[model samples]
Target: SNYSEEPSRHPSLKINAKEPFNAEPPRQALVSSYVTPTEFFYKRNHGPIPVVDDIERYHVSVNGLIEKPKELFMKDILNLPKYNVTATLQCAGNRRTAMSKTRTVRGVGWDISALGNAIWGGAKLADVLELVGIPKLTSTTPAGGKHVEFVSIDRCKEENGGPYKASIPLSQATDPEADVLLAYEMNGETLNRDHGYPLRVVVPGVIGARSVKWLDSINIDSQECQGFFMQKDYKMFPPSVNWDNINWSTRRPQMDFPVQSAICSLEDVNVGRKGKIAIKGYAVSGGGRGIERVDISIDGGKTWMEASRYQKPGLEYIADEERSDKWAWVLFEAEADVHSNAEIVAKAVDTAANVQPENVEDIWNLRGILNTSWHRVHVQVRH
Candidate 1:
């Protein structure tokens, strides 16, 4: 098994594959709380988890278009200022199963649970860039760089025997508001091996692929990373472009995801009752955009009702307004009267006013990369 060295995972997660392990929490378990517990958090791995027996000896290198390349050890990272960011990490293939129903697509068949929000503790990437002698982060461009690339230590056979890698634009990387971090701790505890034990890059409001796990090195490049993940894969194409006639180069890599929402309620049958049925789910947006409102429908989009949004458990709102820019997700719920069998649906609007597509067929693609359609679930009113 490719995951022979992988650690034991929580039995609650719905395991999608045994090797190159991929699993997600159940829908009900997902929205049970605002912040997902580390144990119950979804696990998405592209390749074998690199074995780092000695975390103390593990070092990350920073180079490319810099005055001088430097390697930092665990001790060096701890000395830097630690920032706690509560952000959601969602797989690009999240909700791919729903898209598959519309058309045959290639990739992991992930449900809506392939995402989880948590508090990450680490040093900001911008601060680290400054520490590495990049005096002007916002104004200066290293060798006229266009993107920042991240390379991981984990090996993947899909890439023809190479480490997994991805990249983001230089402007987003240098943006102080990006809240990009070299995360060492997750949810107030040291990250386990499955979750990038020693360190990993956390790019807030971007696709999870950009936040490279088991981070090895970072580079400033005049062009995007030439890795297979950056060039060939993770790009979205129109439904017209199938395997027979597809152009990977024509489509751009998925960076900021669109506004998305999912109905996390699992229970369907309401026995001997004809009253309000409780509905709860999660909504999120990418690129520093907050969710403005989430609307719920019981009769398949005929009428809609606004659901109340909740942040952390005790706090009605996130105390850190600065961190609330677009990192975390909002949980919503509504109690609507259900008199008969009907379809429950949800759609979210981001701060940019971007609403999710009504049907999966509308946004269907070849790779099933981003399926952010209005989530729906059928409910039966049983006597």
Candidate 2:
């Protein structure tokens, strides 16, 4: 296992686990910058990190349902056209801790910082697929399959000590708007070992699990991968089912997540003489549906103030004429009047008009995944 060689992690991250190395940056650190620094990026590992001492020898095998099954070395990938994408990667279980507070759920307890946005540099997955003889996507293409499976080099205990694996629908893999990439650089620097050095897939606008790290191989198949992560886990169920009655196969894996938002202003701040309290936070939506607006409520939903949105300067999204690709989270801020005390709440609306639930109970599932409820935090306002 590559556990022994894993590099030292950032001291600022709040450690959730020591063995698998799950950690998230503090809320303050997360909102401090538009693009999260590589060191501050959240690290979510399910198993041992595969050590690649000699990157030149490392190769990613692409096969299954393609005319030319080929082995792409680091040099081969670098030779292709380089594309830059700015997107946020959020874990499916990002707010698991908040959900656990409502009811018992099994998984790593992650804080709000289990998400980050970065500028990625790599070759487009679609270009690579076509180069390997996978025909250009058409209404009738992908003649051999409907899914693209990605396997990781890391050995995982979750799969009973086997290599980790996951898959996405072929449509998402081939869609030019998806901006899927074989990323070699993060935030303008060569990827660090912790962040899938040498090579990894960056599936923008999807859950972090779909962005397989230490990428080992790619295969096109008739159906989604039957790997443990793709089938038995990372799924959502209605609150009605419990451990005894729940059938893992009955539910489908979670793909694009629901509209979500979080508040970053938690510490008590003095209301200035202007009688306005400053509020700031982050908001995001899945599946390329950009956040239309983020509403902030200071009086427990009686009234709301819309927050202004901002992102990394000069970053362009990959989108077609029909729509804009909004894969990155928007940093927002607003000011509202407050006195004595108040319950601050935040909710976001996606471009598709999908709004976050007002309360967690309304959308609570068996596993506490996809908690896109309005984030609330009480603050003591001083004169």
Candidate 3:
């Protein structure tokens, strides 16, 4: 059960745990490097790592409210034409620490490193669904439609129950922009067992939790999957609510990530001498809106400077450019001259003009969902 084998980690990654799979790259990992290699990328798993020794026998089942219930063996699924997409897989709790500072939240305590960007290669979910007799949407979908749910092949015994499953709205499932996939390869190679060996659901723009790993089955229903992940966990609450006053039924699970950014350059303890320093990190917005700009402030939020930009992963194609569809993180860098010791603050604004809230306390919720506040780090300017 020891799944802590270090694949290929960036020297800059900050270790959080060595077993059961937990670790984060420094914030700079998002900005420092353009393409996050598979080895050094952050790995988040909720159960015992399942090792898939054979792909030949691997099969993915697609059922529920469909004209035809079908089972897709690996060969059959792969035989169809293949499509590739570059996407950023981010854990909904990427900056849980920031939320925890305001109030205690439930679930895996992750910092900024519980995310990674990769070029996933597989048949598009839409294409596969068509083969299975699901109709493609030609116009706006009717309201009150049921949701689509995905379950992981990697199962675990729940403390109070049987198994764990995650679900997302059918709108997200079928959205053309959503570009969800039944991914078999990560970064051009077979997926690592720890990441999800035979298959996994890649639900773009939503949290990593909904992108269930080791995907076993896909179900379309008139209601959201009543699993713990959908009905009980990952829900957001008002700022005034606390553990003692929780109203679980009234809250809603988080679907999209709020606009967020972080500082990746300097660790918490290291202080650079007073001079010129480069600040870099990544910013992304949920619901498919691209990041517009990132603002950096040395003295809290009093003054700000725009960070330098890099091209998004998939949308643009420079001759020498890496993956053009930036479903992954967008790296940004800004240079500032340090004159005196001060606290550095960083906030990102997305193309939608959605900016991180000024303070975490204002947005603090019982479950700690959507904690997009200005990222601040204190450093000394010593000469």
Write the residue-wise lDDT of candidate 2 on 253-289 in tens digits: 8888788889776642333343566688899998889
Kindly report which residue stretches of model 1 are placed more than 4 angstroms away from their true locations once superposed: 139-142, 267-273, 313-325
| Candidate 1 local lDDT, 1-383, one digit each (tens) | 26678898888899988678899988888788888888889888888888888877898888887777789888888888888788999888999988998889998899888899988889888777776676534544656666778889898877787888898876677766788989998887898888887788898888888888898888877789988887888888887889989978887888887788898874433343667788899999998799999999999999999999987742334356524436789999999888988888999999999999998888889899889988888887777
Estimate candidate 1's alpha-carbon lDDT, on a 0 to 1 scale: 0.83
State each model's CA lDDT, in order.
0.83, 0.82, 0.72
Which sections of candidate 3 miss by over 4 Å?
A: 1-19, 138-145, 157-161, 312-326
| TM-score leader | 1
Clashes of each: 0, 0, 10
How close to the true structure is residue 118 of candidate 3, measured as C-alpha lDDT? 77
Measured with C-alpha atoms, the lDDT of residue 77 in candidate 3 is 71
**How high is the lDDT of residue 253 in model 1?**
86
Q: Select the stronger candidate by TM-score from 1 and 3.
A: 1
